[model samples]
Target chain A: MSFLGGVDTSNGVVLDPECSLIGESVRGRILCFPFGIGSTVGSYAMYQLKLNKVAPRAIINRSAEAIVATGAIMSEIPMVDNVDTSLIKSGDRVVVDAANGTVEIRDVTERHVVTSILRNRGRVLILKRSDKVGSYRGSWAGVSGFVEKDEGDEEAARREIVEETRFTNARLSRRVPARGFRHNDSVWTVHPFLFDVSSRDVSIDWEHEAYAWILPGELKDYTTVPGLGAVMNDLLSRTSP
Target chain B: MHLTKDEEHVLAGEEGAARQKAMELLVSLGDIYGAERLIPVKSAQVSGASFKTIGDAGIQWLEDMSEGTRASVPSMVNPLGLDMRRWRSMGVSPDFHGKQARIVAAYRSMGLLPVYSCTPYLAGYRPRRGQHLAWAESSATVFANSYIGARTNREGGPSALASAIIGKSPEYGLHLDENRLPKVEVNLPSVPEGLVPLAGYTAGKVAGNRIPLISGQAFAEDEHKSFGAAMAATGAVSMYVSKGTVGHVRSRGIDRSMIEERVTISSRDLRRCAEELSGDDEWDLVAIGCPHSSTRELAHMARKLKNRRPRRNCDVWFCTSRMVHSRCPQHIATLRRFGKVLCDTCMVVAPIEEMYARTATNSGKAMVYLPTLGRQTASFRTTDQLLEAISR
Candidate 1:
């Protein structure tokens, strides 16, 4: 959000008509937006908010621009950027630790899940989750499950792969850092792993009703779970190196 | 962005809160732009000083920063909303004058020079060739890069102020050698005598964000001033390579392989632009300078109206910097017979909307701003035309 003419300093009301939170007061609130996109005088307008005692308690941006950064420092407002602002919604209680560069949603719980992509030949395996599954029913996903308290990410990935696909001779090919997605009150942090197998044979478990072994390019034809496409792209981009 | 030990110390607040905040601002900007480090700046010219533009928040911010900080470099300010010494004569309210005074006091306490004009290159703070500056005024940034071979990105008001306090700017954008190359070529047609600024206005529209290598006509120094100001206003670029300043661009190593994109700005386009901005002749005020007039422009304008008598047809504002105004007393006196020779402010920065609704200006830059910022039905005219309009 821009401060200059885009917001009213007197009451902290977002004046930009294009903004989603238009007419909503930002005073004493933790304001989250994409980034500032207006005049450099926006910095001064933000300072005016502080002078008028109508400033937000803290600011969270997907990315910070020069105008908002300058205003945040000049006005002594706590600002943290490079956050996934789409996770934050109105009325969500959030705590911003500016110095530590972290944001915490007070009421939201983070769930860790292990998703392993089993590759045989040039085809990647995708499973259609059964209706009996507790979450993401009738949706396509990789060999995914929850991580137990005693297991590391890799151990959980191997365990989920064996339980879901009955594959024991899969070799670890690639692993990347976990990526997070927000869904309702839960933050799903998915740890993705790629495993190369010698055979495409698998005994299906009750967790899935159907299975498909398809090329990575054809994965988009099916409806998959959230962020599954991105996970596949990330894992497959460095398969050779 | 990597900060040196000394820079880290400043950012760590060992240098005090004001300096720490200034360093923090610089570091943030450096990180955002993906710069390796901060480089020392020769000078800084900060904008957003006017009360009309900044209002109470800017004054308060300056007051807060002024408590324990001073400018490390020779910093100059953009024009205030009114002439600091003669706002009463310009029909400014006392409340506005009070706010403007506080802003002036805040800047003065911070050791910033009150050279309150956008054309600081003409007002005694001209940078040397190849010198780095943190200038926030669009016109001055354009002029410094295009005319004097100086390097500066078009900085924001607060970023420029932070650079003034820290005496350093992020080494990115125009500060780097590779970013200065002209990406587009603009071939100008035979521009009329009075349509130089309009030619610039047209060229800027075609240039967009790319720096244009302007060919065709040779422009005087004043022409560069007017041309670049208009370009900076219309386009996102702060620099251009014209016939006169091509030497500066060549010194930075021209890359012809990157100049595949080209655009042509014709005289007919400039004439059309002039016609579109040329509103009714019945104006409430006629303003001369947008990027404060230099001594030569003042002399030229004064010479044009030396023998002509004032018709008292409309309110007139001959804007120039205070330094230039003091230097050209004879020209000032002659122009005063026609209108108020205002110093430290111009028609664009002033609260003209409060006094005049339909304004006329000779500046192409003012043509972009007078209608929106000044809230006036603006009429575009040349220097000769504006002078002729004010004087019989």
Candidate 2:
């Protein structure tokens, strides 16, 4: 069993007001919480970041936020979900390979790929990755996993969805393969999938302490799983309900 | 791709620096927008005409780019300021003066009208949604697209002029019909009561960039203008929310009767709006003039204070076009008795937090309430609400 890292879900994530400035400062690629905090104007800041051509290429989060997701979509920034957030800090050398839904955490030396996507509607999702197994463990994540030895990428993707969302019939839309690229020291691929669900349909799994459909712009209220914000931002951008 | 005889002549350098640069700029801009040829402008608005925030280099670049197309049509403008005199008072330099003069000279040659206010729509230059126009107001873009269904991109000053002189803009981004569709669905708890700035503030923060098709319990047409203003102010974004009748409003569900009630200017509504907005919070700044308040609005302010003394600690400002500023220098003494009246300026281009700690506004438009102006914590309300907040 492989687990990545852990994130604090005791209180909701509180987003930084200057997050937009941070997002705009990164010229090429950056990793952050999937969703932004509650402020619809934050959505505009994201778009402005894109309009000014100053947004990151991709993002990594433990959960995905709808507002950030919408911004990423409108701005056309690539993103991925499900990373071991406890293991990463604000300025850590982490690579979000949105092409493979895996985050390559490279701090000084050791590097590994963790798969996940930040999602929001009813509540943000956070999962604990198993560090002993692979990359993340005891770390809170959104949705994450790796391909099974025999299962195809799409089948593995579906299985991961079931494991994360607890919905056997997620009704996967289109499965896009490797929508991004490899990170600093790892080779991984991502399969972007859109699952149809509303704020009322989601239920929590033990892997996460709690779940609630956070308002779109206020994803920053939750602080534990910062990675979830980045993932939510990316998925929201790519997936349209 | 297809240049007119005059355009060809300008392209061939028959025009002087102002004319040549104008033509070259237009052609380059046209190529970017995929415009087949230059079209005539109904009007245009210039940015950095007085070098408010940008550098002299930006002004010089505009001059160099707009070289040859001086034979352009009549147009409107956003102000550089009343005269070069205000420039030094505002800490503007001589280099800035040279660039501005060059632009002013070019605009004079092209016969561009220098009204110098962002609220051209307020000054009788409303471009119906989807109409090809060269407007330069960012809030105006949000107002036109979200409230009026017009299409434009807050591309920049030069592009706006080019579009006006050529009477065409690049047909991409918001200009495309298909792109205007709402991406998010918002359902509000209730239409905000008078001075509930958060209602419009929430809407703007929630749907800054996307086309938001919202049906809120509290949303009334009167508040739409505040929402639109907030949306435009927060970010470089626009919105599309519905108002029952007027399309946009300064209050909640203000019916025709209320407008009739307000038609006779008693300054009562203004006082009411201000009262409703009175409250204490850690504010970033207090912003006035969502569309650059009209002279009549300023006159009302003067009239209101005819009997009262000026209040201290509050940095109140009245924004207006350059033309309006020039037309009423005498009015300045009256207004100064109450507060500062900044001409050829709006909060849209000027810094909000730079002057105050938080912001408050009375417009129902989202463009002004959104993040680029102040954080989500910024307060909002009707003009009446603002008055209340300030008085308390």
Candidate 3:
């Protein structure tokens, strides 16, 4: 048997008509597919699962969303990411070893290559984004986007920086391996490569309105992704040579 | 920052396991922020509940890892009120119980007051800006650092409690009064006329993440609660909720109809402002009791519901202090029949997943709305108006 655990990491409520069935079927089941979506307030619901002692024993994710990951980490639930959710189904018994960050399905069909990006920052080559992309369309961001078929994840990230920001001569740092998660058809990878751009190399893409060389303290002006901000904060704190 | 001799000793394993663990965590955090020396803190307001209760092991690990050193700061805590009897009946796992007991034991041993609500300000732990406090209320943090001008980082539960125990937090961000300066400023046209709660919500939307020094309104103290609740609701991270009332309006016999009309427009403007300020959905949780609902408000809820009947499937909880709860147990059945009357805890303070309300509405216009604090983001409106929404 295979199971698809419908986990929501929102701080708000995800009201579904078939909530009871999903809740029961998914418990102790192979948590499957996609990063939990919906309201950030759903974070509280995740908390409630622990309070009532009915939380999913383990989580299988395309990628860990910020609130969910933070909440799960804070709550200490086992979770594993980067595994294809398609192999798991509506009813499957599974044991999730979150401490080691792995998952074992009772009867799995196939496996896919799952990579996670460990992003580090020195001078995050920020791109002044334009309105072409939806969401934060005309804002600043680090090298970000999805890894297309055949193209390497690193190439895609660097290409995205160039395509979005029009930077060409900056040196590419080591590729921080990461995964891409599609929560409800939105597929983006977890890996972001770090690069150091010279003063002359810094330029704004039509995608972004402007760019800045900001320290961790100054990065607050531009709203980067939530967990990413915390990550950058950690990097900023590390002792440098 | 230099660790106190006591803190240093803890770091070196002079103290027992709990203190060692807690201090080690603090030192790492301090090193990250470049805090040279640790300072003492008077009080701390902590957030986050037990791993057992929250059911997420990741959260549990984070809690345990951060709780390494039992810092010696006076602290205020959010309620993790677990009815163990109820859990046993549900056949809850023992692992969950053990994790929760560890946290509870830690707090109790530290002499931390486990009030368990996010709105410590209501519980009388208001730390004015620059007051040398260690707090973990997200909305309260925003309110204190931005509005009240208190200093704090968005420190998580363990560090926040530790700082309160040791009486010091890293002097960064809001701690440096200069960082608390208002980057964005908003001005209101006039006081709300009708359903002041709606007007307060409007103010929250307009003031998101910006410092709003309000003008042009006169409100009773109860009304101020409404405004604060609404501001926090609409996502104004911080606010200087001052009296904008002009004496002439009341003295000259201001027409009630005119005031109501302005209040309506103000509420709409608030929604518009919130949309403009926020990036994502701009959605948040609507919470009441920033300072906790005043005793008079609780009394009013009890009296009103005293003669009324409960709406089917509608949960109207009245959160207040224990002092207020003791005054009206006889009305408990009536209140529960309609809604829950929770004491020493409010929706924003305690985890309300069981309440099953994704979005909550309240009445007021000061700075009560804090979606993040509620653990569920929110939308704000006045109490009477919200009652209509909930009923519908």
Give fnat, all candidates: 0.97, 0.00, 0.03
When candidate 2 is compared with the true two-chain complex, its DockQ is 0.04
My TM-score estimates for the predictions, one after another, are 0.87, 0.49, 0.49
Q: How displaced is residue B267 in candidate 3, in Å?
A: 4.7
Give me the displacement of residue B212 in model 2, in angstroms.
1.9
* Share of native C-alpha contacts between chains A and B (below 8 angstroms) recovered by candidate 1: 0.97
lDDT of 2 at B344: 60
lDDT of 2 by residue, A103-214 (tens): 7666533322234343434344444544453543455554556676767766776677676667665554443334323334443454455454433454545545444445
- Model 2 lDDT per residue over B193-309, tens place: 454334544545566576555554544332454455555655446645454522232235422321111112123443454454444455444556666766666665556555556
- lDDT for each candidate structure: 0.89, 0.51, 0.51
Q: How does candidate 3 fare on TM-score?
A: 0.49
- The runs of at least 3 residues in candidate 2 whose Cα sits more than 4 Å from the true structure, single-residue gaps closed, are A1-241, B1-41, B46-52, B71-73, B79-110, B185-198, B214-225, B239-241, B244-287, B299-303, B312-315, B322-334, B347-392
Q: What is candidate 2's CA lDDT for residue B35?
A: 59
Worst 10 residues of 2 chain B by lDDT: B257-266
Give the top-scoring candidate (TM-score): 1
- Find the candidate with the highest DockQ and give its number: 1
lDDT-sorted candidate list, best first? 1, 2, 3
